[model samples]
Target chain A: MPKIATREAYGKALVALGEENPDVVVLDADLAKSTKTIEFKKRFPHRFFDLGVAEANMIGTAAGLATAGKIPFCSTFAVFATGRCYDQIRQSVAYPGLPVTIAASHAGITVGEDGASHQAVEDMALMRVLPNMTVFVPADAVETAGAVRAAAEAGGPVYIRLGRSGVPVLHGDDFEFVPGRAVEMRRGLDATIIACGLMVAQALEAVEQLAAEGIEVGVLNVHTLKPLDVQAIVDAAQRTGAIVTAEEHSIIGGLGSAVAETLAEHYPVPMLRVGLRDVFGESGRPDELLQKYGLTADAIVDAVQSLL
Target chain B: MDTEGVVAELAEKARVIRRHIIEMLGEAGSGHPGGSLSAADIVTALYFKEMRLDPTRPDWPDRDRFVLSKGHAAPVLYAALAERGYFPTEELATLRKLGSRLQGHPDMKKLPGVEISTGSLGQGLSVANGMALAARLDGRDYRVYALLGDGEIQEGQVWEAAMAAAYYALENLAVFIDYNGLQIDGPVNEVLAPEPVPEKWRAFGWHVVEIDGHDFRQILAALAEGRHTRGQPTAIVARTVKGKGVSFMENRVDWHGVAPKGDQIVQALKELA
Candidate 1:
């Protein structure tokens, strides 16, 4: 399978949305090239606006456009997109329930050499806590495209988290994206690895590793973190009786926390969360960072094995 | 324009809006009276004459839009919206009440004619710019107006919007900075001054217009100037006294966020009446 960055897929999806929906407009914070919004700019020059490194202003402006019946997609690095403009999102977009899609690229430690300053380990947490926000951490390029289209159609405040580096394709062209539905990658009776974002790729790898070891472990890709697929998570816990959640974010407030809270209430089971554990990431290559932070498939396998 | 007669009429409207502000704030028992009172005239002028609006169709596509960036002054905007018949005047008493459409801040979802939800300072201007940009994109001729407080400029996002509005050359957008001279702490200049206000706006690529915020005619003319200007957003530096109308509250910093109580409300109502 070809490796494609989710940000690249987002740019393509934006152009398609721009063509289909005349009301769709794209706003970026001067990181058009990095966030891959340049393609949208090239195609729909009139519809694209570079807000000049002002993420907060971009959010407020998108809120305004949404007020007047225009669907605006705000693109920026995940760190700046959520942290810098959280109040703007809360006051202008989430509070009013505006149809503004925050396309946040360069999420997680995979931001690599940029170090912890540029990484958004808590972006999903920030967006998920907001009342009207829909959070999506698409696993691969194909899923990213489908997530963008679904977010645009969902028509409220949405946060789509993307990565800077290319990830292996995880889904087919025919894969449909539903807002709060979890896709079951594999079925296992021993344990299950529930993950979101790029970590889903690692979960699949872990499933393969566990299969070789003759330990049946399933993988559930929870793309939407805000309107969490609670039923799927409960079902997974019931089916497997042990679970492990993996994400490219801090274990405190991403997929791990979401799954834990759901299980603690509905179906309590022995589980472990595999991700950054309160420590900040250092500047390194993407592959090296994953290995250093214990965010690799080995980490998922270990967590699942411990849970079982 | 029947200048005296027009001013007299809008002045009456302003007086009524001011009365409503006092009454509502008195009822709410906690609200920003200074900025609300300070912006009553400019807001009154817009709702009464300057902007093209239909009270019946508050969401009309071509109607002019208004955003209260200094959203703590929502009482004044609510007063104007109520007076303009967007909602019933009796609902004025419900400001900040539980489940009231008139929220503590301007909530577009709750209230009619509120173009965008704003309470945090420095965000409304960007929203106005978005509305103006949308108007241009959709081939509509609707204009957008945003009102900012004197101290609201201290927020960094304001300058970001300032740069963006100018860069976009949003001719359909006009903003009013209610230069009320006082914020919560103390006098604006003494507490992190944003002085040379008009010059700063000019430097930011806006067609700067300074006016007495209380003057009905000047407010209208400046808005007209904004309408005539091309290739740049206009900024009207409205010189206003904090807590303008009420004699006791005039230019008083203490009233910045405090609602009038008992005798204060009585005297304020008597003065406006």
Candidate 2:
């Protein structure tokens, strides 16, 4: 399979959107190179604004642009993009329900070496709790591109979380992404593995590993965290009889908590959450951090085995 | 209207807005009264004399934008919007009530004339910069105005926005700082001084103007200067009394966010009349 970073896909998708829509403007808070919004800046110099290292100002400016009929895509690292500017997002963007796409790159523990300060483990929970916000955690490069395009078309506040590290491309060119819908990657009746972001690829590998041992594990990619595919999760839980959730984020408020809340409300199912258990990340390689945080194929398999 | 005529009309309008602010705050029995009264003249001048707006067409693309960055002054903005016929003036009584369009803070979605929802300090200037940039991008000449409290600029985000406005050279944007010098805690100087405010804005590459915030002529002249400025944004530092018009409430820190009670409301209305 081809390999690409979700941030790279986001950059390409933004350039494409800018070309198609003259109203599409891009803003970055001094992280254009890292966030991959330098691509959009290079293409449309006039429409791109580099707002220095000020996330709150960037979000407020994006809301103002939205009010003036311009669709703004504001980019920065996830930690600064959501946490640093949360009040600005709530009061300016979400309060008015502006069509500002917050393209937050380097989300989750996958943002390695920079340590916990840079990694945004709670971004999903923070954005999910906002009244008018739609949170998207795309599985791979293809889905990231689809998510960017979808956010541009969807005239409201959307937060598209992108990764810093490159992962294997899991979707084909014809892959369609529907917001609030889950895609089942593998079929099984014994147990279901619900995941998002880098964990989707890891869950696929875990499913294959579990299959070789006469265990049939289902894999479901929950790309959209808010407006989550509740029906799909409930159906998967009903058929599989057990559930496991995996992500490159914290177990407290990321994919695991979202899936658990859905199942607990709709159908009570025995479950195990595979991710960091209320701990911050540390300086290490991307793969090392994933392994240390218990966010790998082996961890997902262990979670499934424990549930079974 | 002639210059004197415009000034007098605006002054009377400011009085009406001040009366409404007192009446509405007393009705709600809760709200920030000091900031609302202090901002009355500036907001009145903008909505009644300066801004090119049609109450019937609130979504006019070319309409000048006003963002109340010091959003606790929603009573003032709501009063001005109602007086301008944006909504029924009777709705002024519904502020902070359940399901009222007049939220405790200005809500752009709830009120048609509100350009941007702002209650959080230090965020509106950045929003104004975006609107100015959008005007430039869309090839329109609409101007953007933002009102900020003096103490509100203490938030680090305000400086971030101030820096960006100068960097962008947003000649079409104007910002007003209601330098009433009192916050809820105490005097803004004793609390956290944002003094040398004019120099700070000038250092940030803005055309700095200082004036009496309650003087309609000065307010109108400064706004005109801001409109004519080129290559950089303008910051108008308007020195104002915390609670203007009501003699006992004026400059009184206790009245900052407190609603006037029965005797206080009667005295305030009498003073305004």
Candidate 3:
């Protein structure tokens, strides 16, 4: 499978959106090159604003531009995009329900070697709790392109989480991404693995491996965290009887907690969460950190096995 | 109107705005009165004389923008909006009430004529910068104005925005610092002195202007200077008295966020009348 970083896809999509919509503008906090928004800057210099290393200002400015009928895409590292400017996002963007897209890059432990400070393992939790925010964690480059387009077309505040490292493309060119709808990668009966972001790819691999062992498990890609497809989760739970959630984020408030909340209220099923165990990420290679934090395909397999 | 007539009309409007602020705060029983009262003249000048706005067309793209960065003074903004006919003046008493468009803080979505929702200090200037940038991008000549509190500048984000505004050379942006000297804790000088405020803005590459905030002529002149200035943004440091027009509350720290009670309200209205 071809590989491309989600941030790269985001950059390409932004350039295309700028061509289609003259009102589209981009803002970055001195990380345009890292976040891949420099591409949009190159294409639309007049519409791109490098706000220096100020994330809070970038967010508030984006809200202001939205008020002026400009669709602004504010990009920065997820750590700074969500945590550093959470109050600004809540007050300026979400409170007004502005049509601004917060395209946060380098999300989760994939931002390796930069240590805990750079890795935004709890970004989804910070954004999802807001009143009028739509959170998207695309599975790969293809889905990231679709997610960015969706956010640009959908008015109101949308947060698209992108990874720093390249992941295998799991969707084809014809794949269509519908917000709040989960895509079932594979079907089975024994257990279901619900995941988002980079974990969806790992869950797909785990499903293949589990199938080799005569264990039939399903993989459900929950790309949109907020406005989660509770109906899909319920259908998967009814078909598989057990549930396991996987993500490259904290177990407390990412995919696991969202799925658990859905099932606990509607279906009351046994489950296991596979991700960071309420601990911070450390300096290491992306693969090493994934293994150390039990975020590999084998971890998903183990989680499914534990639930069964 | 002639200059004298304009100043007289604006002065009367400022008085009426102050009356509205006091009555609304008294009805709500809690709000930032000192800052609201202090900002009356500046806001009144903008809404009534300076800003090009149509109350019926609140979403006019080319209209000048005003952001109340010191958003706790929402009573002043709401009063000005009502007096400008953005909404019914009767709605002024619904401040801070359940389902009232007039929230304790300004909510742009809930109220008309509110360019940006601001309650958290130090965030509005950045929003104003964005609006100015948008105007430039769209090739429109609309100007953006932001009002910041003296103590609110203590937030590091304000400096970040200050630096960016100068870097962008936003000639269309004008910021006003209501230097009333008192904050919720105490005197801003005693709490955390942001002394030499004008020099700080000048060092940040802005055209600094100092004026008496209550003087309508000075306020109008400074705004005109800001408009004519080129290459960089302008910062107008308006030295104002906290709780202006109300003798019992003027410059007194206790009235910073307190609503005036029965006798106090009577005295405040009497002084304004």
- Tens digits of lDDT, candidate 1, A69-98: 999999999999999999999999999999
DockQ of every candidate: 0.89, 0.91, 0.89
Number of the top lDDT candidate: 3
lDDT of 3 by residue, A29-129 (tens): 99999999999999999999998888999998899899999999999999999999999999999999999999999999989999999999999999999
Which parts of model 3 have CA positions greater than 4 angstroms off?
A: none
lDDT of 2 by residue, A1-308 (tens): 77799999999999998999999999998999999999999999999999988889999999999999999999999999889999999989998899999999999888889999999998998898899889999989899988998898889999999999998999899999998889999988899999999899999999999999999999999999988899999999999999999988778888889888898899999999988888888889999888887889999899899888
If scored against the real structure, what TM-score would every candidate get? 0.99, 0.99, 0.99
Name the runs in model 2 displaced over 4 angstroms.
Answer: none
lDDT of each: 0.93, 0.93, 0.94
Candidate numbers sorted by DockQ from highest down: 2, 1, 3
Q: Write the per-residue lDDT of candidate 2 for residues B1-273, one digit (tens) a residue.
A: 689998888889889999999999999999999999999999999999889899999999999999999999999999999999999989999999999999999888888999998888889998999999999999999999999999999999999999999999999999999999999899999999987999999999999999999898899999999999999999999999999999998999999989998999999999999
- Name the lDDT value of residue A241 in candidate 3: 92
Lowest lDDT 10-mer window, candidate 3 chain A?
A299-308
